[model samples]
Target: MVADDSKMWRTILKDLLSSEGYDVITAEDGLQAYFKIYESCVDVLISDVIMPGLNGYQLCRILKKDPHLKDMPVILLTGSADSVDRFWSMYSGADAYIEKTSSNALDNVKKILKNFKWKSDMPPQDGKNVFGAVLDELLAETTLRAEISELSNHVEDVDYTIQKIRNLLRSLFGIKAFAALMITMSEMILYSSLKDMKKTEEDLLSRLKRPYFPSYHTYRTIDGKEDVEGLNSIYKVISYDGKEEGVLALWRERSFSVREEKLLSIICEEIGGIFKNIIEVNEYRKNAYLDDLTGIANFRAIEGHLEKLWNSGKNFEISIIDIDHFKKVNDSYGHEVGNEVLAGLGKMLREFGEKHDVFVGRFGGEEFMAISEKSNFLTSVMNEFRQMVEKAHFSQSMPTLSISVSAGVARRDDFSSYTEVIEFADGLLYQAKKEGRNKVISYESIG
Candidate 1:
């Protein structure tokens, strides 16, 4: 599968892959590539990281978890040479990385395929197995190890990026403390999504309606509302083929001073490249650990994260939250609204969880989990979340709705394993529903 937002690049890539005697499938974005994987057998995925929906990293993570597709190799194309770019690409599960502008891009791709083919042709030892069995096992192991190593390295890169972004923001904004704080918060959100390591478009007229980064002044004014007015500066929105995926906004306090606009343009160019790289890395990672519909961490991924946290001996709180009467919601509102609610809840969790050291993800349909480092602070946060949901206003075309969630919280201690912790939290969640729907229950009380 070859996924990119650029028609020219897609055409060029298709031609290159076909010339090598490989079957080629093309998609304009990550979402389309995802559907293609389900519909067909894709031996390899060659994708651009940044697309409108289901960017490369997210796609990659999703693919990695599939038993059938986990062994397939992935190559990410980007225009960046930065350590952040390379690290993320590897971390996100890319087997190989190439710079789009490199003269040897095609040659490098050929080399990757050649190596893959060589491994795929390895002979089986003994008459006990089929010829393809040995090669398949070898490929799968090699790919799995590569993904683990890549994820470790990517996590380190995320740490480095957080630091670098913090410093860069401070230096550029000249508001040391404030810049550091803002950058830290921004990095937390960006890196969290990136670390989930998991990781498109419309026409020009439609594109203009999407959200964008505004000039610094405009950002300040519009911080509280959804309105974008008096935002004099230009904001760039990435369009693939013709569809809009997402927008990147750069802010200046005022119109360019000196040749600042030119400098800013250069910076934006670098950012654009970084954005592309990040998306690619994320897609590769996503192929490893995401649920296609809810866009949350799948069971495999959540278990992996839980084990890591427990083994690391970190102090944290885990909560299992489920929508009260979710089946009824689906029956009453239709599956479409149920999906919307799930997606909406995920977004809300992300937004609210930003206030603390929280990791929120959809565990499955109508069930989600939140992990936080601060046990003492959780109740207040949970209460705030409850209020937020209670007051939330949904689209009016839908039926009148008053929805609630049941939550059970558990704190990790010496005896906890990921399984025990999850089971305890889940039990508590059920208890909450038994006591009363729409209330928070703590595991300690049950113990």
Candidate 2:
């Protein structure tokens, strides 16, 4: 018996096994898989782990717990090469976890099915076709045995995962067009392989209207409903632990068969889990570059921004800002009040950064920094920031009490590297403080 949401895989496997003269059955999702397994005894169950109502793990657990079906060996299929996914398969009591992308997917299925071949005394005929090419040697078992940490090089962000799925479907199944919608830890991402690129989300969502799948139960009992005419596409909603994760919509000119439906479902489910892990990785990445108090980029992020500028060979004007007599403000009020001042300023700076298309972040203590593409008004931006700080009241303790900031502006042409620009800006900033408390100093004026 084979149970997967992908109709493509289901048809291929069923045909392969049937040709070998083995009676075969198929299911589209876990709900259908459960019924198909219980209806009549089968040799071994090959099921895809991620499914609509009941997932592979859920199905395996339920079967393992049931005394009647406990002896039935189960083989689980996954699309992700992630170790977290491997751990999940192991915990589910599956006899094997086959990665769909591995060249050995079909070979592994044969080996697993043979291991659990029922009480029959005779061996089932080898399912491989006489004309089919021989199975290639396992390539060091990468689809599973490879270290998951090595994924850092492969898994960049949700886009990497999204494009990977598109590539896999294209390479393996000849699926040329599909749309994926996912929301990861940092942002919402949308991708579609449709040629037009102009098709809106409304168009994709419209595809789901009119009717639910012709018959959801057709997946469970392969005998249920015949294929609907002109319906060559399939849509599967990916989720984890009862929460909505993402949706995949795909279409081909040919109508999907029972086998392909099961395979596609399993693929979508595996992608959901992969996306979840990616979200966690991205969150960690975002945290490492974020300031704890100011909610802006930290010094580490500043370095990255400078590296980007250097790589792009772009020139910019920069400003370094310092709060006037900040220590006195902290000493007079309290560190808590000082924090409030910084947070308020950070908020205002973030808005200013967006409005002016500049990079802004706290530079430790009461110092802040900004850099933008060269423009005559760069000086005005810096002075405007200083004036805004001077007029702002940070504390409720003394509503009328205000603070001021000093700034120094420098153009990138005056310096070769970020370190040089920063040094030049810092020198001018101190010169301003020395001359007077509230003042904006230009790099040219210092010389």
Candidate 3:
């Protein structure tokens, strides 16, 4: 979700997300945005700090107060550099604060989204929605318990640091107080990382039901404190079923300490548990809908998705791609080599299709399908796939092999069933093979 008063900025942001394959929702102001949030689910919220009818700060406060919406990541974009402005943004519950003039806003947005977790359902609200009320309840009961436990342990070390400072101050110069202050600040930084981790875990658990893996690394500052040069600390929540999920990395100018390490470990463990749950859910979904070998949408998944989209009254193009002389290759290279080629081709198609919003999947042995938003681009994407196959370099030890694919693309302006579009595309693909291998033939051309 993008909320800004400037129509130009809103359009620009929306286009950027669209180009990157995201379905975006836009609002002109904070009030409009609050209504949207109430009505829909948004993965991330990007708001301009200064807006009419509930500014970004007020918006953040409202969201953070709401039990149903507080878990959603809110990023505040400001054009201000004043220390007071930064403090206000933070105090208002903004997860991240960025300058509007900074070229890194987009990067920061990406980072926030990558780490964000959204809740699936919310507890019923009673009276006026208060910020952080439900989250405060949930955290106290679950997430905060884990965090507080970790913090309690750190408190002991902080006490020792205080004692050491007192002794140093009396015996040495009066610099002991400053030294203790610095250590206290470092510990606070560690506490913030841990808190963020717990929130991330809660978000993932609420949003996903799949098994996931969690990994973490802690870095210490140059003075052997809790800062790291490249990373404050890194936490990654990965789906074990092979999908990239959430990654949260905080960067500071220094390194970490023993207390920080313990806190990081606990945070990583909590995050990993949540990820594991998501992965498990994904695995069940995958088993029901994915091809075991190619890892593309299985026939069932593609058919279902296509049906849904078709029924939703959206226009789409479907194409069938067949490997040219694939049987002959299998016979010449044997099944083992043929399987290798199939896997290699599958990977290539996946990577190439990423930039084009094309969904490429194995329809069956030696045959594949690619769906694209633009029917015209289907032919070009297939053409590129064919050229890549023709120029591919196989294993050196095995016999040098070359292969090509023939594709047929079909587009529909009118609503049509999935079967109709697929059949049309398949017919075109057959024509490509019949005319000559390695060519893209379209239904329009054939008709």
lDDT of each: 0.61, 0.69, 0.63
- What is candidate 2's lDDT per residue for 1-447, written digit by digit as tens? 888899998998899778767789998987776665655455677888778987888778766754455667788887889998889888978878899999988877776666665542323322232102111212212332233233335556555656666766665456636676545323434476554332434454344323222110100111122233343677787676655555677666676776567566656656766666765675676699878777678889988898898779888777888888999888998898889888878878888887788899888899988988766556787888788778888777768768898888887775668789888888889989999868889866655
Question: lDDT for model 3, on a 0 to 1 scale?
Answer: 0.63
Ranking by lDDT: 2, 3, 1
TM-score, per-candidate, Cα-based:
0.44, 0.51, 0.46
Worst 10 residues of 3 by lDDT: 177-186
Residues 94-119 of candidate 1 have per-residue lDDT tens digits of 88889988899979988888777411
Over 1-447, each residue of candidate 3 has an lDDT whose tens digit, in order, gives 899998887997888778877778999988788767666666678899899987999888877765566777888887788888899999998888988788887777776676766654743333224334434544434553364334433332544433432342223222111111011101111112232434434433333345433321122122122322243333333233444334334343345555444444444444434444433544576578767666667788777778787877777788888888878877887887888777777767777777677877788887888887674677767777788888885544464777788899898665347788888888888888888878889866756
- Best of the two (1, 3) by TM-score: 3
| Global CA lDDT computed for model 2 | 0.69
Judging by lDDT, tell me the better candidate of 1 and 3: 3
Off by over 4 Å in 2: 1-153, 157-265, 311-313, 375-377, 390-401, 414-417, 435-438, 444-447
Q: In angstroms, what RMSD does candidate 1 have relative to the true structure?
A: 22.1
